[model samples]
Target: MYEADQPGHGLDAIVAQRTPRGGAAQHGISKKYAMHHRSGPSLWLWHMRRGDFDAAWTVSDVVLEARRGTACPHLPRHEQWVWDGTPLAGRRVLVRCYHGLGDTLQFIRYAPLVKAVAREVIVWAQPKLIPLLRTVRGIDRLMPLHDGAPDAEYDVDVELMELPHVFRTTLRDLPREVPYIHAKPLAAFTSPIKRRYGRLHVGIAWRSGDWDARRSIPFALMARIAEIPGIVLHILQFGSGLEELPDGFGVLHDVSDISKMAAVVRALDLVVTVDSMPAHLAGALGTPVWTLLHMEPDWRWMAGREDSPWYPTMRLFRQERQGEWGPVVERVSVELIRLLSREAPQCASGRSGD
Candidate 1:
């Protein structure tokens, strides 16, 4: 007896469970399909990493279909999977944000698309993001996610990550539009910063969340960037890495308020960050951003692509080898110099100073 709530049931039990007599349409997909994709999650990631979205969606359908009626009430929202090939034609869709801040930022672009068809679009997002997400177009209402039941009623539910699959998105048709979420420029940050007109005000964030330390570059290594001329660095990193910043490297800004953070990011001329929330935020706001990636980054970054299809203004700097920041930093330095050399006159004349 395999139980959906059992902590250690694993994939073997997932496929081995006897299907309800009603069969595939009853939400139990074919056993042969399940057996072939023994590692469904890994296979899905592998397909996505290789940019085979059609194949990835096929794997997603089978995986999601297999668990259509299953229940795991004890799991946290972030761990619980939602959406089961449900159509959103005329339903009240509850778009749940059961993931990290960065994940929410990246996928919120799909809200307009969802609103195009659904009767009502309700976003249950992380509390910190509510102020910022309020500015995004097409959301009928916004609710801050909490420990209790959701505040709104909906005909169907889907996790924010599932939006891409729901739309059957491909690299060619990915929602690549910039500035989907708008943030007013912070008067405090904008007025003072504009006074310094000649140097480019480049915001830099070198750390990522602790779940994956590999995604972050050491604060000391950021010296390579600090040495670059004609660019004034503003430190966008918050939490643990601030202590590691050497004296006079950059001006550290408070990122406690996400809305203010968005305003600061929008005010900057360019953002250079690791694969973190800032990267997603900058990309979402349509600001020019350079994302430094680990050798094997998350599947979203995909494999061997310098520019992201999801963000037209983003440029990627990938590690040729795992755990080596030297080459990645060197390449960024060269590019920074070239960019400054080309944009010098405009940067000097422009108000934001980039």
Candidate 2:
């Protein structure tokens, strides 16, 4: 039932019986049994049933074995295989990822990197991410979750997160280019906001949903920032924090959609935010951004670099110690004052070093 023209390519019937698994599942048993079928290097498709404990455990074991030189690479390690780029070149490849927007964003950077070395890179991602990913640079094609075996079109398949370690990436060697999302057409500011906030608009996001305890900045800290003169702090965040916004904190605009968020971000002179998607988006747009990272930050932020290689216009402000926004906020406050006081320079003129 598979052909080159059909979605399944050729192994559609075989994949029909295989159930797909989600992240953190095990697949050692499947790999152990599938080893007997090798003929001119046949491809073994391992399907992980979502939330299946046994399956998750088996897959984890399979991955462990592959890393230890026992079994071949499977889901989760698939991206690593692609990055290694030797075994799967000139062959069809199937790639899968855990289901989440952030997970997708963190790993999708490898798609183009994979495409650089592999003949074909068919990605299996959560349905919600498909629209956002359409604008991403490197994917050859995409299949929604639970799509049957990748057909005869794939000579190999692997999971998404494994790409980095497989490529033996250290903090110094991360693929640091901006790769996840592209700049969307930004809407011009409406006459009212333009007149009310004036030309220099700054966007701020103080909290990230995933890292609430560690990532949230004290409201009082943001309040100190608002107190800075000649600058407007526009609240671009949505959800629960809106209720607690301090009085006289300038305008609070509800940005519920990605496109609208992009537009408002485009209109800003700068974005000062905690580590969140908005910071990433602003960096991607080459907008001037000051990103505040926690003491023990995400690996991507790395360590000891004020400037991000991925976003040229982005600057990093790390906490000197854990759970203290006081010093960081104070530093930002001082920097903002300096930026405000300086006379506007001609276009293309570089500002003095920070």
Candidate 3:
């Protein structure tokens, strides 16, 4: 996908090769798996679609080892061997966030778990995300990833996404504990400009990062869900898809900043978003969130599922057909109606008090 002028049907071959029953047997090349991050998170995506997480380590490790051949300044020519999954009690440890913001949000839950055993845990992350991640439970230090690793001597280091594999996790062993992350809301966004117009305040995100369109929801389709009764919908999206929004809908402006976005999510009665960062943020905060997914969604959501093991607060609403969100949105609207009905009296009582 990185190559714009790539060969014909390149993706079909890539997807087919990595599919569960595909020829990429033994989890690697020619009947065995190779530890290469070069494939990016696609390895995770592959196994995740099949609900197989045990191989996550193998994929991530391949990438870590492959770093030796790259020009990455931080991954100099082998000063120290990569840290195998060992007890970190007295050893200095480093953890780098090498993926997207959403992956980082999902995996950072492991940092506190990592910190429990490690003597010290230093996180090297995207410069912009540092401020947001600083408050997470187990991190002793947080720094932005510059050209190279920071000037610090460390006994061992690991990538953030690799922690799950290091721990040998299974679906049964997922850290379903919500509220692992601690975020501070911007004081500036203390109140919404518009007063309550519905019984339930719902925050919605229909677009993802500027990468692929596979996971995004068209504003036109998403707007239909806003038509549901007793629900106030606020857009939690930013970037290119902004122009497509329906009139009178407010864009979730402060949401572009993860921390402030978190604060906003924390305040919502419920979050209805596509498979994006806001869903992860809402889940991490233990807020009630309904994740509207694409027909063929990411591996994290898994296949044929309505709930996520990663976040107890999250409920999945998947598209019934490819490139079509109407059914999904309609189903969500029905559920929303049912949910708001149950809360009608409570909403009425709260309004009376107000």
The sequence of per-residue lDDT tens digits that candidate 1 reaches over residues 171-255 is 8889989888888777788766666776787888888876578888988786678788777888888776788887776766787
Order of quality (lDDT): 1, 3, 2
Query: In candidate 2, residue 124 scores what lDDT?
Result: 79
Off by over 4 Å in 2: 1-86, 126-128, 143-155, 168-180, 188-199, 210-212, 246-249, 343-354
Q: For residues 124-198, what per-residue lDDT tens digits would candidate 2 score against the true structure?
A: 776645665676776888877654644336776666755653354434455666535654434344334445432
> What pairs collide in candidate 3?
27-33, 28-32, 28-33, 35-62, 35-63, 36-62, 36-63, 37-63
Q: How does each model score on lDDT?
A: 0.78, 0.57, 0.67
- Models 1 onward score TM values of 0.89, 0.64, 0.77
Q: What is the lDDT of residue 353 in candidate 1?
A: 21
Q: Judge candidate 2 against the unseen true structure and give its global Cα lDDT, from 0 to 1.
A: 0.57
lDDT of 3 at 107: 83
Give the winner by lDDT.
1
Local error of candidate 3 at 352, Å? 19
